[model samples]
Target: MVTLTPLEAELLEVAGSVPDPELPVLTLRELGVLRAVHVRDADAVEVELTPTYTGCPAVEAMSQDIERALHAHGVRKVTVRTVLTPAWSTDDISAEGRRKLREFGIAPPRTRSASEPVSLTLGPTRTHPSEAPADAPIRCPHCGSADTELLSRFSSTACKALRRCLACREPFDHFKEL
Candidate 1:
């Protein structure tokens, strides 16, 4: 296992707990946005972050939150860096995050191999065909029923899809895996 200095460990704790602006219910660590935390000195620290998607509006907010969190934790100097290489994947999201998403009335992304093709549509007005796997079932978060249908390709957020449960007859969001 890797060892961390006292300050480094504390910095990690503080940075990891920064809540995502878009999904306030989950932390940056839970959302898998916090990539790394490196202590440059006793008074300075550097944090790396990866966005859920390119051009995600929450990136700047998340970076600001991280810096704020670190400063509040007594770090005199904090540098927040955005890393785009290797990209961000829903697979990086923690299991706890997935559970929390479900509890928040949002269906978590389905686990699929990297080879599986994802059909996603971008833009505010654009729409895509229902990409929900026909074979892989989707259980409703509100009613816990397998009977659900994709209402639209987009939800309130770009990372989610609109869905409705047939059993409960309620609309909810599904966190799409990218």
Candidate 2:
């Protein structure tokens, strides 16, 4: 296992606390966007980040926020790098992040069984077979009811879908699992 020095640990903490611009409720760490933090020298720190999507508009803002956060914490120099080889998945989201998303009036991504087939949706126009089917249930985050309908395949962001609860008659966003 790798160990962190005091400065490196503090830098990581500050960098990880930077929140995603689109989803303010979750931090970089919670969203699993902040991948790694390395101390380059006595005054410089390097941060690695993975974007939820290739063209996500909020990634630039997130990078700036990370640099500002590190600087606020006394980091003299900060370098933020975007990494895409491994790709970002909904599975990277932490349990606490999912809970926070629900608390923020967004439905968390549904966990699929190993036997379930993975369906990928690229853009707003594309539809997936594995999406919440008519027969399948979508639990409402506010009402705790399973009576919900999909309003649209896309929500405010590409990572979520619009949904409404029949029980509470409230509209909400559901985080789509990639």
Candidate 3:
């Protein structure tokens, strides 16, 4: 068995500070993207990551963030590997991640109760069958109102959707569940 050197341990610690490019509020760890960190020898570190979404363009930027973070900590050689076997879901997000999203002004997905209704009201005047509480809250992140509207099925960000808060009359992003 190989023990991680001080430098390697330090590198992982530093890497933990890096946040997801698309969701700046969520750290890689919070997002459950930082799967593993292994320091080989004294100068090289290997990182395993699982992308939030396969089509997410932020992947390259995330890779760069990891490398830069390790380099900033004096790790000369850093390799970021993407692992997608099990795939990512709202379930993988840590409690901290969910909290971060709330603080960042975005509602996280919701965890569905066995008796919960599948379809949710998107706005005061609109309804969508696609609405389902998976992990994050179904309420508005801004006004914390249950009276919200799903403006669009997709948002500018791949992982998010456009939503409007009826109470606050403000548009915000909602992290969609896979």
Candidate 4:
């Protein structure tokens, strides 16, 4: 593991504190997108960022926000670089972030068991009377009921799916497990 200098560590904290443009409830740190901050010069720094997906529209906004944040923190030159080598997964989100999401009425993404990738299975056009995929049940964030059905594959954003609970009859967005 790389050991961060005191300055680099401080800058990381500053950059990570920027709230996500789309999801204002969570910071970039909590979302796990702020990858690393490298000190390039006394007044310059480089920040690595990983997006939720390859063509994520929020990435540019995130970069600009990071740049502005670092600049306001006294950095003259801030380079926000997009790194996709490792790619990003919902699993990167912190437990606290997940709880915040649930409280925000959005179902947090389900975590995978290991390094294995999580598979996506399309539900039927209508509600599937029973929760067949027992493993990854999309529970209602509002009512904590597992009897939820997908209303749309894409919700407010591509990363989330619209779902409704049979128990509470409430609609919510489920962060699709990456």
Candidate 5:
């Protein structure tokens, strides 16, 4: 594991505490995007962040939020760098984040290997969202039923898919595994 200096650790906590732009319910730390804080000088520091997905628009907002938070905490010349080399996986999301998402009427993504890239299929289009990507039955965040079916692959955001629970008859978003 990488060792951090005292100041870096403190800055990391501040930056990580910033709320996510899209999902206000979860912080950047819970989302698993805030990577590291490198103190270059006494007043200037650099922060590393990864987007939830490639070309994710939220990255810019997240960066600004982090910068604003650090600045309020007496940081100057803060630089939030976008890191994409290792990419991001849903598995990086903390358990608390998942619980929060579920509690907020969204289905949490199931655990998967971090190394596995999200797969895309080029099959014939179907009318129902439940036609493909048959990994497993998604549980409803409302009633906790395993009888939820996808309503649309695209929801409020690209990273989430819309689904409806058969048991509770409630519609919700599922954070698609990356």
Candidate 6:
């Protein structure tokens, strides 16, 4: 028979309740960041997670949130471990998460087909908004405009970039293909 401690189960539940700081529409579990939950002895809880991006600033805040959540669940000690060996990708983003992103006015990351690198090729030289890599084409969530302009490589959030709709001339956020 399989058994799970009360604390472990509560930890899992709390983790699920935590949402992604950048994209509030998705939970940590939806983002595949909540890798595993386990109880250490009677008073400690350990959580394994991976960040969407290596330099993602939310990691610290996330760890703190996890600790707070576990503590609230009556766990005396909490440990949050970051696993990076198997790096996270947009593919790890859940189907529901993708839908949530679109509904939130942010286009999901473009799909990278089988047996290909996750690289974006804007053009022969400088990359443009309209010209994505050969395998991926970024779609504007606001206007559904493939014809877009890369306003900036970075956006208000690390996971997204600033883009403008050529058709509507409205600035929008494009989830970084990475």
Best by lDDT: 4
Q: Which should have the higher lDDT, number 4 or number 6? A: 4
The TM-scores of all predictions, comma-separated, are 0.86, 0.86, 0.79, 0.93, 0.90, 0.81
In candidate 2, clashing pairs total 0
Q: In terms of TM-score, which candidate is stronger, 1 or 3? A: 1
Better candidate by lDDT, 3 or 4: 4
Q: Locate the minimum summed-lDDT window of 10 residues in model 3.
A: 125-134
Clashes of each: 0, 0, 10, 0, 0, 1
The total number of steric clashes, by the backbone 3 Å criterion, in model 6 comes to 1
Writing each residue's lDDT as its tens digit, candidate 3 over 23-112 gives 887888888777778887778889988888786687788889999988887889999988897787766788889888988888887655
RMSD each, Å: 3.6, 3.5, 5.1, 1.9, 2.4, 3.4
Per-residue lDDT of candidate 4, residues 71-129 (tens digit):
99999999999999788989899998999999999999988767685666775444543
Expressed as tens digits, the lDDT of each residue in 1-178 for candidate 1 is 6688876787887899989999999999999988889998788899989999988999999988998988888889999998997799998899999999999999998887768776667645422224544666677898888778888878989999898888899988989877
Could you tell me which residue pairs clash in candidate 1?
A: none
Model 5 spans with C-alpha error above 4 angstroms: 113-135
Q: What tens digits encode model 2's per-residue C-alpha lDDT throughout 1-178? A: 7798887787888898888899999999999888889999989999999999999899899999999988888889989999996888888898999999999999998766656777765655423334546554667899888877778989999999998888899999989888
TM-score for candidate 5, please give it.
0.90
Full-model lDDT for every candidate? 0.85, 0.86, 0.77, 0.90, 0.88, 0.77
- Alpha-carbon runs more than 4 Å astray in model 2: 113-136
Q: Model 6, 106-162: lDDT tens per residue?
A: 777776665777655554633464455444556678778777777777888877877
In model 4, the number of clashes is 0
Model 3 regions more than 4 Å off: 1-9, 112-137
